[model samples]
Target: MKYHFFQSKYWVIVWSIALFFFACRDPKQNAKENVKEGELKEPQEENAHTTVIKTIPGGVDTPAGMVWIPGAMFDQGAVAQDQMAMGHEKPSFQVAVDGFFMDETEVTNAKFEKFVKETGYLTVAEREIDWEEMKKQLPEGTPKPHDSILQPGSLTFKKSKSSVPNLYDFSQWWQWTIGASWKHPAGPNSSIKGKENHPVVHIAYEDALAYCEWAGRRLPTEAEWELAARGNRKDKIFFWGDDQDLLGNQANTWEGEFPVMNTQQDGFERRAPVKSYPPNDFGLYDMAGNVWEWTGDWYNTNYYNEVSSKKQLLKNPKGAAKPFNERDRYAKEKVMKGGSFLCSESYCASYRVSARMATSLDSSLEHLGFRTVASVDMVKAEKN
Candidate 1:
């Protein structure tokens, strides 16, 4: 069946379920009971309308370029004191958000193949390179690299052994293989074959947009994405909490030696199943680990400073009005939140709740995915 955007009528029905029951019960008394059970209590009936408690399902499957992130605000950005823990997550602030639906997991290879099959869509990587587009933005006299060099693909790490005791070269692991699109993730000769359940990788920003459009959804904005990932926690290191090792099991990561020898404590060297790990407080899965998901906001290292300076309540703050920077100049590098499996404490320690990063809009990787969201009407949501 063809994909359709989430319908408002469905949510209205969900809200109705919440309100109808609460209207007949005493909320204050219920709140106490809820607390005892470690559950969120529905607001007590103050007026004719009563509050409803709705439980949404988590970890549903979707095609590539999608993840489900239950809506709720925790903390956005980071502060100076949290610098050592998370630098980019700076300028921490409390952001109140309404309830909304999100993808339960990242888009998988099997799902993306369906989109390609139904729509016959050619991803940005499959299209021919625009030489003029490339030259217009590159520095003067850069010797216009061969089209072969500019071929569409993603960076994949090739596992290798290191002889030096202390000199493990990580650069050797990252290879920009040609023909490394979603269909052939490892290069021309590779295929999805039995890996349909794996997260779809090597997809660029435009590629994600196409799939979202086909699926009747859009990429989450940076704020929406982070808020959903955080799940109502403020100033915490990881999504679950400050304690990184709360669960002894490693969640979607390379354990052992950096790129050379992986202990596979997480069960896989590459991407893991969408629901392999536990969910956050909001019932969102794979927020902290797995593949990094893309957001709609443009990348700016100092965007937090601007967010802090603004006096207005940034209801749904989108980044800069126009694109900036070299990456932005080309196709506008969008913000990427939620560190990937490649993240390690010793090297790229970005797997924190508030951390942020960016990549070229046209570039896709085996380590990126996305999710969707919608607004929640307070009056309607309460009634539900």
Candidate 2:
């Protein structure tokens, strides 16, 4: 009974906004930490080395559109290691990831447009979602939603006149507007004409995968994502560190009140262009805020326990088998690392490095976007 309401009510809210402050998703395919099928492409020959010893230094060839993330050993979780940290991120353990190339900035509209123009690839947001596809996540014998409700649209954040709206009911902030895609960010009339440099939004996991495939890249694993994010500064509160006001412009996060009002204290009501904020130590941009980055791990609250149990220096640690969101068992969700533009310190301070959010693979949003990474082996193969 509770699960049904979670889907019926929350689904309507999150599905329209990709997420309402990082909420529900499909449990099976949308496992919070792990990505569903078709997210990874097969590695071809010339992919000889997947992990390189830290002792070995530079000498490898560099790739276009990406920067090399030097291999390192570090603790990959909440730096403060305090009560405020989410349980799913507790018991920080030592994780070693080999050097790999990562995008200097999030995939931008102009870049994704080039991919679409060359491949004529249409994103999931550009197509209607069939009820049959949705029923698979619901209980048996569930009735389909209205056709209009299934139109090609992504979730978007909407503020209400009531400054103090119902926080419990996110419907006040989330709306399933039609024609909300990478091209039409806010709605049918919105355009990315001048915002081409901004990070592309309204991208599903698979949609990101499609862009990666065409570009000969892949999404970063949880370990890779964290390693790259920390920029070798392990166990720090954020990529920048413990100080919230570090640099006086720590990434791009909400300033004033959340949900009801965003004073744009950071000079951004929504997403600022990629690299708008200062880069991390490794010269990586937007590692903390800007938009929640998709990671290649299944959502598991106990995933840390699984890693801690390993007890040994883990290598390329993958996420658990499937996601189990105790709050909404029916929602399949994937891990969304690095919070979004909507994240406010007062409400959802998911911008912290260890912070984790979840949403369904089928969902899209105005604030959710992803970056890409190349496996050591794949890069080797490409060079060969």
Candidate 3:
């Protein structure tokens, strides 16, 4: 699990699953994952014994810092015109989702800091690598790395000095930076002191879950997240209700040459504050650009195909029960929607609203973050 970007076509299957599956799996199950010593803190559930359904006095109300996303039927995957559609997006099917509350934007650093202060939490990126626990996630005979190099760290992107032709090897730009926690975004030298409004990065699944539990929220399901990202404008190539200039600062994405030079036309070399651009039709911010938001779905290369084969209008799909990599059976990954700031048309054209990426559940990177949903039903399930 590290930084990776899959190509637009069949190549998406192998790399996207392994790269984007970073910690977006079920919160409860992910919490059980092994972390390096002193890396994990037992998450708290104050109302674990209470499973009663709680609705607003008026029946359905919105949660603070969230928008009410009216449910509807929409084409959930690659449409005919989407050239950037990945192989997994095929057999696009109709999906029906119930109305739910979703965050207006990615969880800002200020919001996450409040959760950390309240819960006394430590993200997985802040701890050492628990090789014993990690072995279960990899091939049985995979050799472990040196202990000295296994210290707490997270993936950070490094732009190249000059343009290069080959876009296949993603590791050329992605580096595992020591001390790259949520607080220290780029590395130990960087800080979030004045960046409270920026969306928090380096968030692993557990970190996101802990924040949601503290706020009585949950990560949106794959369908729900896609529905909201569309902003009720189905069939559009991008999330802005129409295809705009992705090469410009239409949203926070690579402008010049990807992984090489960036003009910073949008005025940001790193993360931009939440709501830096106009909100979508649903009044949602950063639905397409900014950071990649973690979805609750466990990714399978053929999950959508399986659903399409069922030949039924799916309802509120939560994704596969577990991650399965077709190319590497031992690898696990989770679905992450909404390509990040690093997404580029020249490389990973994942900025398309339907585009998806997957990676391991333990990976955390500078461009990965998440928002939360406030579905009373989902909260009830979490409590139980």
lDDT per model vs. reference? 0.57, 0.71, 0.71
Query: In candidate 2, which residue ranges exceed 4 Å CA deviation?
Result: 1-10, 13-52, 55-59, 81-83, 139-145, 163-168
Per-candidate Cα RMSD to the true structure, in Å, reads 16.3, 6.0, 8.6
TM-score, every prediction: 0.72, 0.84, 0.82
Candidate order by decreasing TM-score:
2, 3, 1
Q: Tens digit of lDDT per residue, candidate 1, span 163-273? A: 323323323455556677788877888988988888888776777877877776667777777777766575566777766665225367656666567776777777887
In candidate 3, what are the lDDT values of residues 324-369, reduced to their tens digit? 6675565456689887788777777776788887766666789999
Model 3, which residues run further than 4 Å from truth? 1-59, 134-146, 246-249, 376-384
Q: How well does candidate 3 match the true structure, expressed as C-alpha RMSD? A: 8.6
Question: Which wins on lDDT, candidate 1 or candidate 3?
Answer: 3
Q: Alpha-carbon error at 378 in model 1, in Å?
A: 16
TM-score comparison, 2 vs 3, better candidate: 2
Q: How high is the lDDT of residue 138 in model 1?
A: 39
Best by TM-score: 2
Score candidate 3 by lDDT: 0.71
